[model samples]
Target: MLRCNLICIGKLKEDYWRKACEEYEKRLHSFCRFTITELPESRLPDNPGKAQIQAALEAEADRILNLTANTFAAALCVEGEPVSSERMADLIRTLSLHGTSEISFVIGSSFGLSDRVKEYASIRLSMSAMTFPHQLARVMLCEQIYRAFQIINHGKYHK
Candidate 1:
């Protein structure tokens, strides 16, 4: 089974987000063993300075790096390459065949991923250049992951 991890900063507190995530998670079981890990987000005052944001992101990056020590890392960033569901499925298939036991997708907090975190990534994947709340990003990622499985298996969900 493919071991896929979603490492994100902060908790999903909204009921709708939680429910959405749960639905995709249940569907993901047929594709991969999914692990969702939450890292603490720094509590900064409103209108934080650039330095403050950078520090917070650095702290979050450290947590992510520590947790994903033995897994292939994919950093979610606006500047990264955006791949199609079929392409992502093909990538997953290749990784499975090549003996990649685990894969981690890192989603940063409000200010986005730190430079160090981006450097740590084996691949930088972008859902889009447009900004979205981290909570929505998680739900979107989960759905796409499940969709990727459908594409790989030639399931009707992909049609």
Candidate 2:
């Protein structure tokens, strides 16, 4: 089975978020081997300056890069490419067809990903034009992945 990873810098603290992710994960079983790798989010001050946030993002980016070095990396950020569900499905299918067995999607903390991480990604993905809490983004991503699989297999869950 293809190994799909959601490498994010933080954990889901709320029961509702966790439960929602769990649901999608459960649905994804028949499609691919899925896993969520939570990396420690860097500490930032209450009133962090630009430099401080950049430093923390860089630190987190290092860890993200290390884990995703051997996989197809996708960075989720506000400025990333806006793609539809069909496009996402196509991306997965195309990657799999071209010898990519592992695909990693990276979600940064509050300040978002560093330039290094974004530059490293094979594709940068934007969930939407509007911003969302990182925690909620996680759940949304999980569902989208499951939906992508359904679309790929004609499983009647996407539409």
Candidate with the greatest TM-score versus the true structure? 2
Weakest 10 consecutive residues of candidate 1 by summed lDDT? 22-31
Compose the digit string of candidate 1's lDDT tens values, residues 43-84. 898999999999898888889999888888989998889998
Error of 2 at 35 (Å): 0.5
Predicted structure 1, TM vs. truth: 0.96
Q: Against the hidden reference, what TM-scores do the models get?
A: 0.96, 0.97
Best by lDDT: 2
| lDDT of all predictions | 0.90, 0.92
lDDT of 1: 0.90
Model 1 regions more than 4 Å off: none
Clashing pairs for predicted structure model 1, backbone only: none
**Model 2 regions lying over 4 Å from their true place:** none
